[model samples]
Target: MSAFPEFIPSKLSFHLDSRLVTAVAVAAALYYALYRLQKVKIHPNEPPIVASKIPFVGPLVGMVLDGGRHVKSIGLLNRDKPIFTLPVPGSRIYVVTDPALAAAVQRASKELSWTPLIPELTKRVMGLDADTVGVVAQNLDPEPDEPHGFLADLHDMVYAYLGPGESLNALSLAAARELGRQITAHAAQLEQQSETVDLLAWVQHFVTIGTAQYLYGPENPLARDPRLEQAFWDFDHGLGRLLLGFAPSLVARKPYRAREALVAGLEEYLSAGRHEVGAAPIVQRRIEIAHLHGFSVAATARSELSFLFAGIVNTATSTFWTVLQVCARPALLAAVRAELAAVVEETATGERRLSMEALKGACPTLHAVFLECLRVGSDSYTSRLVKNDMLLAGQWHLKAGSVVQIAGGVLHADPGIWGADADAFDPARFIRLGEGKVLPAAFRPFGGGKTLCPGRHFATHEILAFVAMIVLTFDLEAVHSDENISVPPKEDRVLPVHILEPRTDVFVKVRVRDARAVVVV
Candidate 1:
């Protein structure tokens, strides 16, 4: 303790230094007190008291922590109410849940605009610059001067390549059937060899092949090429990154390297076709549309990838859930099979195969089951930015430029809209004109209003046909009986990625059923 020397101060000197320290402390306290008083004066908590503890970055951090579950939970908290305010970075967003409010938002499309945050995030991920972003933004907006040329061109392009009069539907149907046969054949081969394969991976492979055939044509390399097979796998892996608003800068710096690989392949494909104009109608059409609308090559590629993501991912998930639900509920399975038997018998061609019309009318119960699956499992949410200050939900007054969103998770399960058994997975709930009546406009799996998905009819037909064919041709049973095989619980965070994925890994032991032995309804 005495290793160091110390000098002792006089009592008078200590007292003098202490007084100086007290004066400095008093001045610091006065400055802080005044600063707090000034802050309170500048920023006041307005009506619809949204708490903002940290400015500009608080809500963003919160949403990231739980992947937007907090936003959905806020909606659930105010389900019965029309509107509530949620604090987002630099602004307060109103969460609207009431049907009337939703309708009002839909109707006021001119006054309100779809939030650009998501689209902006997508652009960032896709490496789009300011000019490309502006073009896409203009294209998405409903403008009086724009004349709907882009949309019209897109429709005609789809019609030309995949429409009823062209070879599109025939080609699509052939592709679907061939892919189905290939999948079943593979399954049979696996069974013969005593292989316990992953059903989900197999389904993904089937979907990837089928979808690639439809999009790029049966002659396209991706349809059969093994190297391009890895592209689909990469694309599938990149889907989560695309959806979760993963920062573009991160994608640019990450290991996935999906964007670079896809772009390189697409460029090579396009360059080889420069002298072969009109060789591929769909590809040509896409390029033409992009050029017409002044979108950059990258933007066009992103748009195509957007379509790929939407079609493959959602369809795969829906089909996966549909198969799982049917296997778990044997009564529902039997009902669908009985319906398929009658329809297939009446419409069987000389080849004893199901026709398009037969598939269409296969079973009311099957349709109900598909609808219920959609209602129970759909993961899309709708959002719009207010253009003018207005009162919402009869209470909260939102300012211009404020963002409002409706959580589909909460809306789909609202007791007031869907009755007391809203959360129950009952196919009869949607069976119109039979055992159960169809619900009202509240069931919006494809969304509602002017911007409703144009591909709804096609998507529905595809899903229904796939489900009916599977049920009619195969006997499916869940491998895990105790796993609560209904659609995965909505609130479970462990299944967040499941929203965009089909539970393909959930094994449903399947065996081919003889068509003749099955009883007709």
Candidate 2:
């Protein structure tokens, strides 16, 4: 007792320690109570809320960890239900899993509008300056009496130039011709010896060069400097961090630097009048519109970054998947080759030429393969901002300012909509229904409503043409121990993307056919 006297606790000290513990517990309980009180209350008229273990923090953490796939996880919780509410910190995202509800969302485009989100997207994604963003924001939703605003006019112009007609046909023919030239030139090199390449890398290289040359004319920045092509991809790789807008220069430094380089390249390209010569008519019209708005050349060039992204990124990714899927299956490859042969015509000079019209409209198996790839390979999200509190489908009341999302992955995988084998990669899914069947509402690879992708036709022609040339001209085999070609798993952590890229590269050995036939588009 005498040796340990200093370590002994007095009754008074014990009482004070107990009092402190009680006070801390009381404070924690009160704080938690207030936190629970602050959460949004679900009314009877609103969609049922998916409960989280940690209240306000769970959904936020899920999104932070899962990226675009978080919605799919939440969706799994209520697979039987069509729609449900997910509460994150300071926001509510209503996820629609049912195709019927998605159709309804499209019908309510004005009320659940994508226009309201454009200014924010421009500033964060396109890096547009405040004044330029302001120009884009004008007349986002013009009244009946008001003159049409920039957004409306831009939409009208895009439809005029990109919609089905001679203008779209001209653009398609240009891309097809350029891609055919690239493939033919590459085939000549492969004739002597087999070349091993990363399938995705090779696809990106050809697609970027060919598509950029067509859209921006011969003097396109990407074609002039190869480094800018890498820069654009680097920026694309780090897109998720850039989209979050949390001190991008520090957190996403590489992509930010790459973005700056692209902006400068485009600025120089526009200043030099390169776009004036052979650029696509739609691209030329876009420049004219920018000039009419009194936008500075720098800002106008920055705005073109969006156009570049829309045209190149998804198109290349989709092409990679299409080629991989077709090459990996010998039966599918044979079918594609046979179908393409029918459309390819032998010329007087012994050169073979493919008409874009026949390739797009006549190839049944090829078209089905294209549609199936989009259905299974895409993970796009269609988002709409609720303008005001309104009843959705006369049942669920969505609050003003909440975001509504329709995840393509979730919809595409629903067995109820796509049948029992929804998850399987079956190209025959479309062929079984009938050739030229209108795509169901459930197919959302291009998204839906007023924000449907305007470049869909051009992108389709490019992909179909590239795949047709590659499968017919060269023999591709996976460079691996296994005889069967292996398909890589997709990258799932990125958000706000139409296509989910392959996680790993599939290297293949390419050898040209012995006949050495030339293909002219």
TM-score, each model? 0.77, 0.93
Model 2 lDDT per residue over 73-148, tens place: 6786688878888776777888888888888888897789988898888788778889888888888877668876
Please identify model 2 stretches exceeding 4 Å from their true place.
1-42, 143-145, 435-439, 514-521
lDDT of 1 by residue, 1-521 (tens): 45333324455567778998998899778766644432331123222433434433445665656554665666676665666665554566666666666777677776666634545755655555677766655545546666654444564556455534445455446545655565556545545333333555656666666765566555444543456656656655544455555563375234136655655555555546541332245655677787789876666666665555555666666676677677678787778777766766532432235555655565678777777777787645567877777655354566777787655566777888677898798878665334324333355566655445555555566766676666665666455545434444543222133234443345555666633221111
Error of 1 at 375 (Å): 1.3
Error of 1 at 223 (Å): 2.9
Top candidate (lDDT) = 2
In candidate 2, what residue range of length 10 has the lowest lDDT sum?
512-521
RMSD of each: 6.4, 2.6
What do the candidate models score in CA lDDT, each in turn?
A: 0.58, 0.81
